[model samples]
Target: MERRNCVVTFLRVLLLVLMASVETTALYGVKLKKKEHRNAYATMMYMGTPRDYEFYVATRVLIKSLVKLQVDADLVVIASLDVPLRWVRALEEEDGAKVVRVENINNPYKGQRYFNKRFKLTLNKLYAWSLVDYERVVMLDADNLFLQKTDELFQCGQFCAVFINPCIFHTGLFVLQPSREVFKDMIHSLETGRENPDGADQGFMGVYFPDLLDQPMFHPPVNGSNLDGQYRLPMGYQMDASYYYLRLRWRVPCGPNSVITFPGALWLKPWYWWSWPVLPLGIQWHETRRQTLGYAAEMPIVIIQSIIFLGIIVMTHVARPGISKLCYRSSDKTTSLIHTALKFIAIWSILAAYLVPFAIIPRTIHPLLGWALYFLGSVALLSIAINSFLLPAIQVFVPLIGVFGSLLVMAYPWYPNGVVRALVVFGYAFCYAPIAWSSVVKVLARLHVSLEREQFLKLVESSAPSGFNKLF
Candidate 1:
């Protein structure tokens, strides 16, 4: 009994010693972590847009790419309080971003009818100053494409931003030294009616930092010391997409050509598939998305749509012969009216075939894949209307061919300048207009013959034609 008691006591003591060692080790790890100052690469997200998923995907791509680059900084997102919880969770769990939710900053300069609706909530960007946990933060816009790691931007002073415009600094990407005091002062400034010429963050910021345009250029120190004052960023950090389109190459002579920003028309943003054919640099954005964030989130919807479209195509093919058996001939006036109605329906359906797929597909998909899917889906839909109505296939598909030709013309790589590209596209359109009109005329003529009384009787027979014919 004594020996057994002694052994049990020994085991208890050993277990206590093991627990102590574990606690000690944990404490040491925490201390080690504390020794490293945490800086952050931050992006902001707000609610209210049909394109939320695309922008969410964009943020993920940005955060995930930064993580993949192994930048010595935390990935952060300053999301508005109203941003969906699911999106916040994805940013945190999937993209490894530490999301800081803040109330939307009310824009004092809102309510003008002509104001761009997109910038209504943009004043919320002021919340970036409130991210005090990080010593420094690089606030980013979702449209930016980071070509390589830009860790050196973290070393910049109180504020730094790229001057993509000659006289105005672009806010698409900027560095900030997080300070609560600065945030509060900015809020006060807003309430006091600070002169915001354009009534958006971009304009307000331009006014607030009036001298940034004249500030000395930023240069990261070799010794790795943090900077302390505002400085102008080199053009390479925010190379405009227009610059590339003009020259078909990057010609920014100074600074590391580190980032590309699309500050053009919202429709022309890099994520849109159509943007790529017009601005070739968009392919690079899609490539980054493919490599980093991927289209996994978008794939299921794309596949479902493809399958539905395919089923429509197959069903149409099966019903073509049955549909043809129904067409025979009727009265001259009745047949003419029916022909007009059929023509209208055929044209409307063809238009829908091209447009509906373009609307429904995920907008952020790669240009080649998106365009191909659109074409396939459209052809499938067009076949149904053409076969069902006995419309001329060649004439009906003319618009589709014209659209393809337009894309080819817009995307031609050898144009010397944007002017030449525009002129060529205009010329193509001018040349194609007659062909399109001729196709329409041919289609109308074909309908006149095809919709004779016997064919009309046959057309209605399968789908209860006697009642339909009686109405005429």
Candidate 2:
């Protein structure tokens, strides 16, 4: 009994010592981390796809500009598996900067084929930031070009995040203090869809840090005009023609020989001007001269295509006046068209609406439009089957043409050939065997012949003939 008691006492003492040592080590680690964080300053950017070349250029320019302003910052650019490490390194080297390559994490929604590349890249950055000793970190999108100094971002400390006004938070530009807890929360939120179920990191952050550190976060005033009641930063900060002209004026007479021009109103952008005389010179030019020329070169092609699309609509209207009457007569078509046209008109009326107004607007609006177009296309396609028995082929095709044409109009600006390509593929499949089968079924059903019964009887009676047969 004494020996057992002695052993128990020794074990207790050993356990206490282990606990004490662990506590001391943890304390030392905390102190070291705090010290490292104080001196660390980091910035991160993501390039998920090479298609984001504009963003890439903007990021490069922003980082180079930041360095030029003498900011002691480390800019880390993250790329996916699709992006070659050598290319990324070359880009970093060109700016005399360094980039770290991170492997893409598997996302269930994105799958192994790489759907949500941006989301994966961002999560990787957050994970990396957690490992590093960073006091403050700024995350900027590759599209964001910094014309002025962004050193003020590093000054933000302790708070979960510091950024531009919530209304104008581009998500492209934000600063945060790194923490393991924050990284874990981000991953959890992404997996569970609890924080930002809609999948926006900015939205998640906004909700996560509402009462951060028991103090309301600071949202800086927009430097530009606020007449339109739209949240927009100054022109030089995030230059886009539509927003600039709307808040300011069309022919903004600012400094000497410096006039900010909104060359593209609704359907056109500044780059669309083929004539050199019409093109604005000096500061009014787009950030990249090549972009301006590319826009100009591409505009004529778009305009020509629009004319062709319009001609198709007109031909359909003339060829099948009955379908036109149905569309114009229906409450839904009239309402939808009027509503869409009015909204477009209202947006176009804003002086700067064509330029960068979209930049300030909630990102949800674009996706909403896309969804609306998809819904309308679906409904119109469904209508074709319902009206097959009631209307002629030409009439049915008329409404389909109109519905698809509208979707094409709305999407062409952003997704150039997406709608057109889909339409062509669909047309090819429709013209093949499926359409013939549908026609045969429709005709048989109209003639009071049950198609299924008729097909089965025909198969069984392959050797038999109709009319009177020799019988007993």
Maximum-lDDT candidate:
1
Residue lDDT tens for model 2, 391-443: 23443334344444444443333334444545754665455445545654554
Which regions of candidate 1 are displaced past 4 Å?
Answer: 1-38, 217-220, 223-236, 243-255, 324-339, 412-427, 454-472
Q: Note the residue pairs that clash in candidate 2.
A: 55-142, 55-143, 242-352, 242-355, 243-352, 246-351, 246-352, 271-295, 271-296
* TM-scores of all candidate predictions against the true structure: 0.79, 0.38
**lDDT values for all models:** 0.74, 0.41
lDDT by residue for model 1 over 225-265, one digit each (tens)?
Answer: 42463224442345567545211122222345577778888
Model 1 residue 24 distance off true place after TM-score fit, in angstroms: 35
Global lDDT of model 2: 0.41
Worst 10 residues of 1 by lDDT: 26-35
